[model samples]
Target: MSEIISLAAANQHLQYIDPGTGNSSGISEMLAPSACLNAAEKKLAFLYLDNSVSSIAAFWNFFNSNHACALLSSSMKQEFKDSLETLYQPHFIYDIKRESVDGYTMEKINSSLEIFISRISSGYSVHDELKILLSTSGTTGSPKFVKLSEKNLVSNTKSILEYLPVQSSDVTPLNLPIHYSYGLSVFITNSVKGGKIICTTKDILQREFWSDFEKYQCTSLAGVPYVYETLFRTGFTKKKFISLKYMTQAGGKLNEKLVDVFSQFAEDHNVRFFIMYGQTEATARMSFLAPEYLQQKKMSIGKAIAGGRFEVDPVLHELLYFGENVFGGYAESWKDLNSYRQELPLHTGDMATVDAAGFYFITGRIKRIVKLFGNRINLDEIEKVLNEQFHDSSFICTGLEDQVLLVGVKNFQDDEKIISHFLHSKFSIHPSVIRIKQVEHIPLTDNQKVNYTKFMEQHGD
Candidate 1:
């Protein structure tokens, strides 16, 4: 490291704020790892935390080192979690205090994480190339994980910093959880630049969240397409703010209608709105629609990030990404991570087409999985669940370009209600976006397999 860079890094700080109870903490980036992370068992560990400061502090100390971390979400299904326990057996686990919701007691919420971790007996061995393990949005209840190395993280983070012009003076409230790649990317990109991250567990809906935002002088906010929906509904535009320098939208595509709204809003306020696109496999981001061409390009995933390249497959038209940030591969458990291959120009599994202006537009999913607000859910996985639960019922699941999933269930009692409840309880998907339709029968091809195209054509709303 440069002497100047080292001197400035020494002055950098990390602040975490709790909007609910109004508690806060400050931790240094250079703090030593906990005693739990000794040489003997420092190979792999699981990291789960909300946007809490203590957790973030612990994360920097433990996760941002030689000991690779398997980032797991609390919202993930138990089946997937169990599979991870069997697969890449996390040598040790580090999770913070789970945020208390309206119904759960404080004690219940806090103890929940510990109770769950205690259930795991032993973990499998992690691979050498596995510097970081990230779950692929719980798609299909399959133990699909994007295995990233230190090179992937560093390369991608540097690219993000290069474009965003991140600075040590900048402050961002850690509104997004660390488990999500998008959220963790913000933490890594900001931290590397010696910037401040104000960790918080407060919901964006709460007034206290904004209050803390103002108090901490938060310079930027990041969210998925769904968050923009609520942001407008909450009258976020009416609020006055002097500090917010930029806003980034990723996780999934934000439709043109909202894009127009955000584009104009950001311009009027003199704040940049970056429409970005990426996959967890690329270590976080591969492309971002530059703020200048946001209106002209309109809904394009834009061009590749610095040092990254993407090409469309001639036959499948699936997007394939090439970059140092592209992951080694996926890991279902410790054994899978045992030997990692360098995957360059990784086939992204998303169908797409390139614009004349060099922008990329994702058209459809060739992979049975669809990402909902950045979480990947396999249509087949949903079908498998329904089959296990209902013998007399037949089900086919499909998703729209915008990620709103559709389930066509035939011969099921209270089909909508039953399926909606099951999806919510099992997958943590809300019924609001899930459209349940009563179908006479699932469309099938000559081979007797469910014809997804025909099913969508016949019953898609």
Candidate 2:
């Protein structure tokens, strides 16, 4: 691979913190050192392998100026990778270091960015109209992607900035992964206002993380249900973030009890806690429970953003959204990447009900997929993983909206605690969201099919 530029030489658009030292220079508007793709402003698309601070810096280097890019998790399985390679045929793949990359042309842009190009042309067109490609519900294995345009990204970013005003003086930690849309939006919105970001991979459970959080006087933090639960268990009340002004939550429904607790905490500390609702297709967020309505509409996902509004389907109970942020649609293969106009007022697969005050509440998902800690866990995919791990034992997987997973296993010898822990560490499922139950047997109907309804009814705990 030819070396294009070293990180030390790249432009510095924003001053980032040292992950180990927690030190950062003030925000700088100077163009961050970035490489110009050979095909500047061309209707080209490339693969982005996961979140690396530097790679993202390189991405912003050209996101709007150069070419459209598709973001993917680096840890995707091979079979899925092969299928995707056949679909969009990303002109280049960005990663940290070089390895076997399906024999694509490799080039080193800098310490944080590596690019691999395809040798043979694939008969697919990444339409000039397409901008960003995001995975649907964080499913790396799924071939389908959400197609977003420049208008979608900028409009959503502006709406969020309007509600959660930021400043150049503010210092926010990069608390979420860059590959995740929620986390990525934080980076984009903060950048739009020229706010400083304390980028680190530190976990909340770590003492060093807290020390760094305080050292920089970080202004805000973001998390999912699992993160807040960890904070509660680890004594979030006693700990003090003197400079912290606000926090945000999404990805999954928060328990009603925790909502009351966090709302009170915000009041006592004079901080803001934003409860939000969104999907990948919405380009990140569609609605949020404003701090003012936290107590009155405790569970409502507040009214739509500035230029958007939503309606509930009386019969299907699906949330229908009319907004500029709605994505172009789904793309499963290269053939599906053509320029297709998106009609306003889209159907969100989430089943919901609206309150008298015009606020929306998500009651359940229209499908069986469960959103846990911002990750999508398919019951069938999870069951397949469990079956491979728990040999000589059988289990059942059932999923629903706004609830934890219920895993039922028969003839199990492992302790329940161990089972939940394994699911958390191995499958990335939060321990609090997974419950292992000892069942008599896998529930079945007279037709010899797995009776998911009867099984959940009997074993759900």
Best by lDDT: 1
For residues 80-131, could you state the per-residue lDDT of candidate 1 as single tens digits?
A: 5556655655655554434322222222112212212333334444555567
How accurate locally, in lDDT, is each candidate?
Answer: 0.73, 0.72
Segments of candidate 2 deviating more than 4 angstroms: 1-14, 21-35, 38-52, 75-88, 110-112, 380-397, 400-403, 406-455
Per-residue error at 15 for model 2, in Å? 3.5
TM-score for each model = 0.86, 0.81
Candidate 2, residues 162-236, lDDT tens digits: the string is 888576777778777766778878877776663567777667888877887888788888888878888888998
What is residue 75's positional error in candidate 1, in angstroms?
Answer: 6.1
As for candidate 1, its clashing pairs are 87-333, 87-334, 88-333, 88-334, 89-123, 89-124, 127-337, 127-338
What is the C-alpha local distance difference test score of candidate 1?
Answer: 0.73
Off by over 4 Å in 1: 1-30, 33-36, 74-88, 96-124, 138-142, 413-416
